[model samples]
Target: MTRSATTPRPDAAPETAKTVSTGLIIVVLAFCGTLVSLQQTLVLPLLPDFPNILNTSSENASWLVTITLLTGAVGTPIVSRLADMFGKRLMLVVCLVSVIIGSALGSISDSLMLVIVARGLTGIGTSLVPVGISIMRDHLPSDRVGSGVALMSATLGIGGAVGMPLAGVIYQNFDWQALFLVSGGFAVVMLVLVMLVVPESTVKTKGRFDYTGAVLLSIALTCFLLAVSKAGTWGFMDRKTVSLLVIAALVLCAWVPLQLRQGQPLVDIRTSLRRTVLLTNTASVLIGLAMFANFLTSAQQVQMPAETGYGFGLSVIETGLVMLPSGILMVAMSPVAAWLIRVHGPRIVLIGGAVVMALGFVLRAFLHGSVLEVMVASGITSLGTALAFAAMPTLIMRSVPITETASANGLNTLVRALGTSSASAMVAAIFAAMSMDGMPAVPRWEAYQLVFWIGAAASLIGALIAAFIARPQTIAEALRVPGEVVATERHEVKRPEAENEVVVGGVVTDERDRPIKQAVVTVLQTDGRHVDWGRTDNAGRYTLALPSAGRYLVVVSADGWGPMSGLEDLGDADLDQIRMNRRLLLTGHITDHGDPLPQVMLSLIRHSGEYVATTHADTEGGYEIGLPPPGRYVLTVVDHPTGRTRSRAVQIGSTSATLDLDIVTGIPRPRRQPTEDVPVR
Candidate 1:
């Protein structure tokens, strides 16, 4: 693949496209994360009216929130596994598109069932935050990874905090449908931005889609979440709840063994067993429960009738304002979490976050006097939630292989969602059991205090679990400043006298046996001293001039490929048997409205439903992307100016090919041909 200086290289990666700033990338991902989470609470303020609008009972109307929780919990792990197998960006966009379509459907729907279904579709967006975090780890440089992941993780709190107030304002001034309309619009914007900015992950665990595992998991989670959600309404010991729990338990018993035997399980049982992953996930579930407790209780605390003594009697909009500080704190604390993680490791951060959450709950339990106190307490819990969330992903990344990062995080997110679901159920059940003595509809201040205490206990348990999580070497490395000196550094003898600069190196290739040009190959002497290093060229070949070529450990690494190391006994003769495998790459082009689209953004998406790469169209409308060979990809052309975009799924092979994109309009844009103006209706 090497080219002569005089020859024109085929699609030489545009100089402008060489390196994108990590800051911009994280900002896009954080926005997407915020949008995804914002959908969760967008319908919060509109729930009461559902009974009237859809002509359904209050219980039936509550399904608007319930269905979303169920879907997010059940769909997250499934979508995550897909992301791990295919592409993270692709799945993220798919999740967002589902939200857009679902929002669009609900915006016009009069049927209660249809609205519930639309809300369920919106729930899929919850998984995007995890997938985005995984994408950050894959694409962001090492130095930027912590902060990028921190911001992405914090969006969950940020979006949830913002959603309620925003929805409240819209409900007051506009139709309820306006919420869905606005949500759909935001999702569309997020979709375009993600496709433009994020790159698809090259690392993937290739295998057949696990339909059985996916189905079993969906069934198990649905049963479990459904049961938890209905505990307050149906009674904890009701037949329906008992039956659902039984079904979940039985299905899980069978599912665990089934995954253990699968060639490629949906939730990799082996990786999940790792102490770090296990404890981190355990903490995730507990902290998720504690974190969501604040969300469910804060508004009620502010909106209670003044007769209750603890009630501020604020409107929904006013309650939202009171909770605004909580969201602000979450956003503000994310950088602090990132700093702590960089300096002290994610394990410590997880534990610290849990402790902070417990403190927040404890503080609220003891200081429930005024609106200011309530807001301050809520802010503390939000800060803690931000930290815990920010650490969970980092812990998962360190525990699992790069190939499994997305799925693992997805599974972790699923666990957190389950916890959040539990929080909802727990809060409802507690309030239902301990209501105002005279008025059955309201709960006393003491009841709220009890919930706070329970949240504190849950967080304390999370902190305990996080403290037990194993510390991975990667975290250890990250905790130390890059230039810090190690007092225990091993000493090695200088071997300059035994020099034999006869190049003893070979090329690196991907799993498909194609040369992976420009990969870094390093050689260290048997005594553990860094001897030499170099990079592969256009042909994925590297030549290392070793010193005295005794047995040495060689390590090879590329951006998209997994890091590989092996022992090699290099000598003067016959030194050409080194090769490495990496993920595949593909390339393409794009055009706009009937002409070349210069500077337009394009996303190379896999048909399995994940994004692979983001590239810009050249001055002549030419663009290129990288992907694994022998799979399908959807080339997306994003024309921001016209908002007329195109997405067509296409298949490709081992070698690169030409695929030009055309402008498309899902929502009609102004046509080039002039049309007669119509009279206003």
Candidate 2:
């Protein structure tokens, strides 16, 4: 009904029109991501020499690496959630600022602790990838989102690959301080470009920040990451590691329920648990585990001493060059991945990627005869990583609320980092325990083979997980606005400005005028073409984008309440307070023949095997349970003592309805004598 002054309408004057090219946006964001990721491995080449450089123990120097992982794990979700609440571009700028400040600090300080602190600050930039992906979803035209996201996601691998050689060159020539100074300069440039180029999106969830939940989550992640990352050195059975793990487990046990109770949680646990999001995230972890093995092992394998039969004994610079093609292949495969995602939905892309990765690892396990073979094998895995990485964000965004895209993608990124961390621990353990006998032990070729086999197994497992992701039945279903119901075939309701979007905001309330929190409001054309959908906030407020002004169907549904739908001629006006009166209560009687079946246990299960409700019949055989949104269900009634069960198929409508079940007639039994005391309906 109205437009904000800050967010000019699409038809605004030429001066206010969007002029930035999408290609420039993608490049700016992707390069920003490249710069941020470079921070992760920038100091990696200096790890060995860090003890002397900082006058600290080797273990302390290792924190230069471990600290980044720790802070990245903690910062990503918090920054992502903030991005959704405040603004994506704002957070992007904030992350870059963090990188700039951290880099500057590192350049000026040689103190081991101070540099570790600097690295920790730079780790906050890890949030850049997820937030950048969310921005692309908000800004890019629908057609460009796939390829744009592909290149952005691929940057994670690109930076890691580029960082090694880039850092080696800097370390070889200039002072080590130049590494931080160079990265800081890039961060400064990115910060300036992002402000000048990227548009700050208006899509945001209105809610109070969940500070308590964030604190608890941070503590849990810190403990967990420390335990996992240090377990290789500390021993898995070490008391410190075990204690940290236990603390993390207990804290998470507390955090999940707390999140469930929050109106605006740091993470939407319910949405995250949705079949698509959950499975995609699971596959993400496996993919990360499989993918990182190639990155972690490739250069090391090439640089092994010549005494090792499979070693090339290449210098650091040469090893980095040898591994560089994998990153190049990842960039080159971005368009191909996008094309596959467009032809086949993200589900298929994920599955295909997992399979490719599995085959690549299989090749790695056996094909070490020459540098060319190793490069090709690793490149194949990187190709798959590009595909999988690209598909994951698409799947997640499609499955989550548009308002929570940044937070959702942030969680995906977090799980992926977890996968990478686990891989690091696994590789370290395997190599350490299986090394060749020498004063300075070298990992045997068999150890590398074992790692490759495990990597292959992980990839295949990821493929299996991706295989289980539910596929959308139509192109519209796949591309439906995030947080909206699937579009059903319906007659087009032609109207002016069919291609334009109208911002619709409203509150959902009951007949008593009580705000209904978390209700799903769906806007569709009369013919069932989904326009948009949204979830009410704590105060029952929602916002959506309508495709056009015309007669349309507005559907609202919430837990413990009946669904409501109606038709209205919607135009440049907010779909104000939609009142829902009927509460869906499935009530009926259960009887055995003509007799009441008292105390019978009744369970309503959906056709897809999701449990909806369970209750017990009263002494008079009356039972009532609140129903969920209308769906096909099996109403199963069982007598506890006799263990006799009867299930009747039911179809619930939009409003409440009554259903009387005859238990005896619902189930077939062995024929018995007429005098036999068998319950009858």
Candidate 3:
């Protein structure tokens, strides 16, 4: 799995001994890192020009930026996992290539669709920051790792801060194509540096690809993000929006069970759920939202007219000039943040950074009229962002296993992107709601002030979450242990041994009394304790160990077969034989039947219980329900086209054995009327 880059061994000497200089490597990688965030903000000023250039509506042109953000949000975690599985250097180079190609395509494109596609391609490059940061740790000396990480981390915000004014300059002096050409030049430079100085790390793991988890997660994320991003454009309560939301929910429901069952998951759901990782990610999201307020307010304020009673009325170049100081402040503050982490510790630094960011927002809320006020506010906010961004990686690295450092960091980055995307959508919605007569008429001052107030509230919440995170301390200091700090609090719970034993027998069948495999048998006490459990062998036989002797309820469950339950006295015989009856056989055909209904999925549920199952009827409309346990069940059939559904309750075992269903026809009648004797045989 090794790539061409230098693979540093864990016990090997620091990268300083290598022929290449450590400082040179940092600069090279940092420049490459700059391309990602740069792409995001560089397009902001050009958004106004999209409609005329592409002959598309303003809303359609807006997707150029929104699509890039959405793609980056989805791509970061996926690419991070790939980086770990393959090689960091390889992934980094691949990302740079994408940026180069995307920028080239965008530079020459005349159609709005092609430019949007190019922006998405460039976003794939935007996902490389976390991967680059993780690789830096592997190659840099321990002494340099802290500062190196700080610089790399700050690049996320720094690029955006710097890109704004740069974009304005390019947009004013040249065509919009110049922005793409400039980014393409940056990418070309990074490609050269990546090949020469950046060394690869040896941290690797062995596992098969978790393709199932990846696909399901992607679908869930795409659906969910589309719904959220479109909420502002389409009414939130719109039916299409609600339908996408529902689909997203269902896909997520399926994803959880699938991930838990897989041995090697894409994102470590278990570890990510722990208090340390969980709190850090939560704080990251809030901080991301707070940090994004800077971009929203600054970009709009600079371009707005001073006559609007709130804008500084700065030209594009002037706005870039206004933002220049904040970028400088951010870079300057990175090393200081690194030093603070070494002394006062990361937890305190993170909390302090959050509080400071909150204050910056409040300052913006009160004083955001003149260029001076905006500049001061930008500096304050960027400084806080630099501090918080620097501390997060240290916390995550300390919390997660060494093997998952890059992947965990990637997920942390994704959370931040999620928060930013959410903020973008919220800002769009607020502006849209406040506007009148198709123009932004809301007092420019109030609009900026409201955004700052929102940011302040978000930062305050981040501060509170950071306060609850356990501060990093030596194991001996925290638990009185001798050598190291052990993660005792976040340890997984061990399963308890059985306290008692029991055996049960069941006759499994597939409607014709044929035996079934993998049937699950269990005994549940009244107190919610599982007294005994076992899986049925090929012969439909099972045994279980009881937790204690008591009156318990026995249940048998199998996939495709209905569940069976009964009372059992474990203190007595502890042995029981259960028979499962073939409930209802709701067989139906799926076809146009004069009108075409394609890809129809049928769902069935037991009237008295939560037993449910789904199946897709073939084009011929032919479908059958396997052996259902004896009970009253509700059967529902649905077609995607009309969303038309038909439902009815039919008693199994007692009613006629054969029941036919039709989608277009009226509900089928029960074979035996209420006055007739329902067959119980």
Evaluation by TM-score, superior candidate among 1 and 2: 2
Candidate 2 ranges with C-alpha deviation above 4 Å: 1-18, 481-503, 546-552, 568-571, 586-681
After superposition on all C-alphas, the RMSD of every candidate to the true structure, in Å, is 22.5, 7.5, 15.5
Error of 2 at 72 (Å): 1.2
Q: In candidate 1, list every pair of residues with a backbone clash.
A: 89-611, 90-610, 90-611, 91-610, 200-612, 510-582, 584-627, 585-627, 586-627
lDDT of 3 by residue, 584-620 (tens): 3556555445443456877778897676778877766
- The Cα RMSD in angstroms, rounded to one decimal, for candidate 1 relative to the true structure is 22.5
Which is better, 1 or 3, measured by lDDT?
1
Model 1, span 558-645: residue lDDT tens: 6544456767666534444344443334444454455666788878777887867787887887655654546776777777887767
For candidate 3, the clash count comes to 7
Residue-wise C-alpha lDDT for candidate 2, range 1-681, written one tens digit per residue: 233212432322234345777788889999977986799888888888999999999889999889999999999999999998888999999999999999999999989889999999999999999999999877665566788899998887888888988999999999999999999999999999999889887766656999999999999999999999999989999999999999999999999999987778899898899899999999999999988888888978888877788888987778778877888788888888887877666888899998889899999988998889889999988888999999999899878867788999999999999999999999999999998887235898888999999998998998898888887654334355322223223321222223344455677787798888888887766666556677776777776655445677888878867567778666644455777666667788888896888999999999899988889999999988875677788888999998899887887765556778778786422111111111100
Which scores better on lDDT, 2 or 3?
A: 2
Q: Candidate 3: misplaced stretches above 4 Å?
A: 1-16, 436-444, 476-681
User: Model 2 misses residue 593 by how many Å?
Assistant: 18
Please give the CA lDDT of all the candidate structures: 0.75, 0.82, 0.70
Ranking by TM-score: 2, 1, 3
Per the 3 Å backbone cut-off, how many clashing residue pairs does candidate 1 have? 9
Clash number for each model: 9, 3, 7
